[model samples]
Target: MKKKIHGFIEKIIENDIKKNNQMILRTRFPPEPNGYLHIGHVKSIYLNFTLAEYYNGLCNLRYDDTNPKKEKKKFVNAIKKDILWMGFNIKNITFTSEYFDILYTYAVELIKKKLAYVDQLTKKEIHDYRGTLKQKGINSPYRNQNVQKNLDLFSKMKNGFFSEGTVCLRAKINMSSSSIIMRDPVLYRVIESKHYHTQNKWFIYPTYDFAHCISDAIEGITHSLCTLEFQENKKLYEWILTNISVSNYPRQYEYARLKLEFTILSKRKLQILIEKKIISGWDDPRIPTISGLRNKGYTPESLRDFVQKTGFSKQDSLIPLHLLESSIRKDLNMKSIRRMAVIDPLLIIIENIDLLHCENITVPNHPNVPTMGSRKIIFSREIYINRDDFKEYADDNYTRLTYNNEVRLRYAYTIKVTRIEKNKKNEIIKLFCIYDKNTFKTQPKNKKISGVIHWISKKNVIPTKFYFYSPLFTIKNPDLEKNFLNYISKKSKIKKNGFIEKDLPNNISCIPYQFERIGYFIIKKEKNKLTTCHQTVSLK
Candidate 1:
């Protein structure tokens, strides 16, 4: 069903290309350098780049750094880093500020033709004049000013003749049009603040709506694709090009933006979270930022697969994060080496003293993959298992070990509980068990067990802190709340004294591995050198 719909959209794209053969199809991923790129930006980047790839065209990375108040060079660098991490390379990296001189000349041309004028009305007054859909807007006092006077005033405004917000250059668009965006939209405004890229060369700057269209045309872009929010501005986009007499105007197309369950895509809200220290930073592993995902154990191949499987859509949709997670799990399950780690450890002591010595037991890197070889893990009189694996009493459905119940200690002999020990808090601290030596590999027994759990010898255990990370939000749609902070998950705990098997490699980097029944984790390196191993695990 989805393929048929995508094929239909593909045909429209093909027809567009056929009609405009003179202008080679070129698209762009333009983002404001005010904040870090999130998962939503990933979708946009993917869509534009994928479309360009399909048409055998080029994709440009254009930074819409028109707003100097909130943008910075740091954000520009971070955005570039993110795109590279996502395995995408743009044909060129450009900025809207690069064509400031050209845009200024175009603005002058508009003013000389009596199509624009410098207005002295305050922002509030301008808004009041630009009435709602049912009402016609009031004309500005200088709307009918002479072309020569308007040009002189615009030049003076550029030379810092007017204070910030005291003057603005607006295009003389329709005043009675139902679309509010066409009611003499402000093209350029005076901002005294220093820009991150262009610096203090000019005090006046062009707005996004004005700068974006011109930049696209200047770059010879064929498809000016954007989110659905810009659908209403399509007419104005064409109007700007028509009035300026641009020979080859780029075609504008809108698609639904990506919205994911349990993720918020608002840059303003994300900024607030960073400022308030609610998150570590933009690249915090808990965050959905591209860098964050990379740090959290996501591979480029996995991300590309995830995006391809999700495909494209016209209607707004909230993708189940499960789809992405499933892809990662499938990719990692084949690649990640198997290891034993007990987060909440429960002691299991052997009843027989004859099996007190440590024995080297070999285990496969992956269950079905033998070429990957095996690692030797020690088996001794006592072992550490998961606390959830045992109970004083059990029903038939309980697969793990229980009182007097026998279960295989994964890749080893089966063991039965002999006795249980409890502490002052009435919590079971340890269990006494005995292994069936007759079931050793040399003399295989015909006995069968319903469940098998992983374990490491207590004497050869590596005690360390395991930081378990879950999703930052408790709900599916985080942005739906009036205050996203209210939906943060407070139950996400960090265990400072988690345990792992002795067989785990020393000083492991951010390597992904399955923790048996406890899901996947990657080792997080810490600043302080703790002699004992410490790892942060992001559970899948």
Candidate 2:
């Protein structure tokens, strides 16, 4: 069962349904196919698809591929893959190029109705004439071109007579409107470049402002949702739909976009990171993209829970990145199996035990999840523990292994540090310890052992490389900085050598495992003898 969704948009939808019982609620997630989907896009996807499911309506996945210069078929396929990975089913996949004929017809209809005209001004001149918010726009000299001449020029534009930036189609709205978007916004422009889908069928393409609402109307979409940045463009959205001959006009709604701290959600900036080799690729674990999160061992359930926790609001706010980490931690805590790994190993030799002897011990996969079963691990006389777990001298609050103190070796027997072995440089090389054979699961009768540490048998250990990650940026709002690159964290990724239990399954799964006392980690096997372990999140 799913939780009831209650928001301002849901209330508006309910009122609309009440006004007209026959009305069918339809929504669509329209993304420009220029880059991969990030966490910001996931919020919109969750809203549109979940709302459709809750209201018993239909939601479509539409690609706003009007700009052929930056768009690609690979991006379209990647977006589809991301939506599927988020556990949402795409019922109808569409592209703005699919309705090129109908859109051109609609543009021609506007021209014949004297509502739109062809503009011969250069791009810069049009921008200067549009004016700023404090200044009113000036009417274009060719605004009153006769319908016949405008149609002839537009037809010539379609036939590739004009250069790419020479001419464009603009709506004939008021020049002095308070809203700048209403000041005769350009409807269509010549791209010259061949589209990935259309493939040189025509040289002209409709702008997003002109094609989006019409495309929504053609698909019978009832609610067209967008981020708050497009609140001003909503005027042009309604204007184009109202002037055209389309019957079904979709209403537009604006919500606050996701702004995460210590992250950059802009596709342009992400592209810069990729180009400059600041990171690996879009799937780099430090990035907020969907694929990156997946590669970092984040589950779909965790992302969905995060979206639900954030909800939908009209006011924009910067969300703390820790909230997202908390969701993933809660999810992995319940499902991940517990294992032992030693990063930065320190050798411990059991002087009292036989050097060649080994014993088998059964350990539960998860302490809380008894039904997950158990696995047997080899416990030999020689073992390796984390270097940080032991200290030559101890403080009163310290509860781990130290000189002359006894500590339990996790699920194995209790051991006491008898002496330390050091090198000529005064660095501790190893610790000689004696095990309490009578205290496997019981405490020593004469002494209190309050410390516990995880260890792996030297004879049954698998060498692995572990990757630790920190925040990509140093400051909270790096996106607000002029030079975000300056704030890039130098210690974002740190690699270390480690040893994992040898009884790991032959067929490695994508699911993360809780490395006892450390954090959750996902294993990646390499073609060589070594394996790589990626830390998903710290044990908080």
Judged by TM-score, which candidate is best? Answer: 2
Q: Which residue segments of model 2 deviate by more than 4 Å?
A: none
For candidate 1, lDDT tens digit of each residue in 58-176? 89999998999999999999999888877787678999999999899989988887889999999999999999878999999989999989988999989998999999999998888
Could you tell me which 10 consecutive residues in candidate 1 have the lowest summed lDDT?
Answer: 530-539
TM-score of each: 0.92, 0.97
lDDT of 1: 0.81
State the C-alpha lDDT per candidate: 0.81, 0.91
Error of 2 at 224 (Å): 1.2
Candidate 2 lDDT, 1-540, residue by residue in tens? 656653688888889999998987899999999999999999999999988988889999999899999999999999999999899989999998999999999999999999999999999999999999999999999999999999999999999999999999999998899998999999999998979999999899999989898999999999998889999998888888878888898998889999998999999999999999999998999999998988888889999998888888898999998899999999999889888999999999999989789899999999999997899888888999999999888876788898746789989899989999999999999989999899987776787885899999998888999999888999998889989999999899999998998878766656579999999888888788578999889988
Looking at candidate 2, the ten consecutive residues that score lowest on lDDT are: 1-10
